[model samples]
Target: MTALLDLVLDAHGGLRRWQDARTVHAEGSIGGHLWSLRGQEGILATTDATVDVQQQRLVFGDFTGPGLRGLFTPDRVAVERPDGEVVAERNAPRAAFAGQGPDTPWDRLHALYFAGYALWNYLTAPYLLTRPGVVVEELEPWREADEDWRRLHVTFPETLATHSTEQVFYYDTAGLLRRHDYAPDVLGGTPAAHFSEHHVRASGLVFPTHRFVVPVQEDGRAASEPVLITIDLTDISVT
Candidate 1:
């Protein structure tokens, strides 16, 4: 294992705990201008997400409307009623976003796919660095937040569903992920800077409760305005 990877995994509650985990549950609300821009406002205003620990699957409870459910996997996104009546579903959902720009409005399936894959990756990082088929290299240190943060340039294989094939993660001295940079393909490769903060532990794992995404500036820094997405998590549990 790489030295930095070891530090990161251990800091985030360790690989052993993660290996023993089957699923993670968190209650949170996601909001920002991006929602309104994509025409998916209020879908996740007050919802709970259940992530399958070892698979790229996430289900949002009461996600689309009153007493509805949203299921997201790498290959499919569906909205169903509480009794399992399918309201809407799409196959190969990523293909539906082809040739789209940041301003292009997304349908409900598009929003579900994006939210599912994005959070699945975010909630399982560093350990993701340890997964098979992932390439991880320690890059030159980055100076941010008045400290020098270590950088990891990660390349995900086709098997992983994520924001992009390649991403850069910045970790503080304590090995907590502070910032992540990527160009989201669904947004026509919009360069974005995602920040995670206020980490707390649940079921022997660590996670950030307050997270936000902003535009990446020309100088490789985060812009101060126009928050694209904000997520506030609470009551996180894993088993």
Candidate 2:
């Protein structure tokens, strides 16, 4: 493993421990005006999400409204009701954006793909960097607000369902991830700065319980306006 990757994985919890924990469960509230804009308000708000860590799959739901259930994986996504009736589904969800730009019309399935892979990537963290086909390189330390942060430039394979193939991760001196920057292709190439805080340990693994994503300026600085997304996770477990 690269030195940077080694330090990050060890800080979050050893790679071996993460490998053994095949699943993670988290109860949380996810909210943002973006959801309402997409007509999926409250879809993931007040949710109980279970993630299959090894397989990169997620099943989430029990929302307040219609009690929607969702299943998401790299290949496809499906939403069902409490009665196990499939409501919406999309196969090869990534390909759905072929030749499409940021203005592509989004449906419920697209939202599923966006949320599914994004959360999976977030929850799996440094361990995800260890996967095959992920390329990581150390970058010069970033100095911000009088603190120095180690940085990594990562390139994900096309098969991986992340915001974009290229992303940058920033870690504090203690080796915990503090910020991530990416341009989400699905969102019309919107640049975002994602910050993680309020870390807590569960089952030997560390997780950031609070997360925020906001728009980034042309110069790669965070905007001063409202956040695009906010997620607060509690009651977390891994096994």
lDDT (0 to 1) per candidate: 0.89, 0.85
Over the stretch 1-239, how does candidate 1's per-residue lDDT look in tens digits?
Answer: 67998899899999999988889898989998899999888878896999988888999988877788899999999999988899999999999999887678888899999999988888877677878899989999999879999989999998888988999999999999999999988888889999999999998899999999999989998998799999999779999
CA shift of 187, model 2, Å: 0.6
lDDT of 2: 0.85
Residue 234 CA displacement from its true place in model 1, Å: 1.6
Q: lDDT (0-100) at residue 45 of candidate 2?
A: 79
Collision count for each candidate, in order: 0, 1
Q: What is the RMSD of candidate 2? A: 2.1
Tens digit per residue, CA lDDT, model 2, 41-83: 7767776888888877998876333578778998888888988
Q: What's the true lDDT of residue 193 in model 1?
A: 93
| Window of ten residues with lowest summed lDDT in model 1 | 122-131
Query: Largest TM-score belongs to which candidate?
Result: 1
Looking at model 1, residue 224 earns an lDDT score of 85
Error of 2 at 57 (Å): 0.9
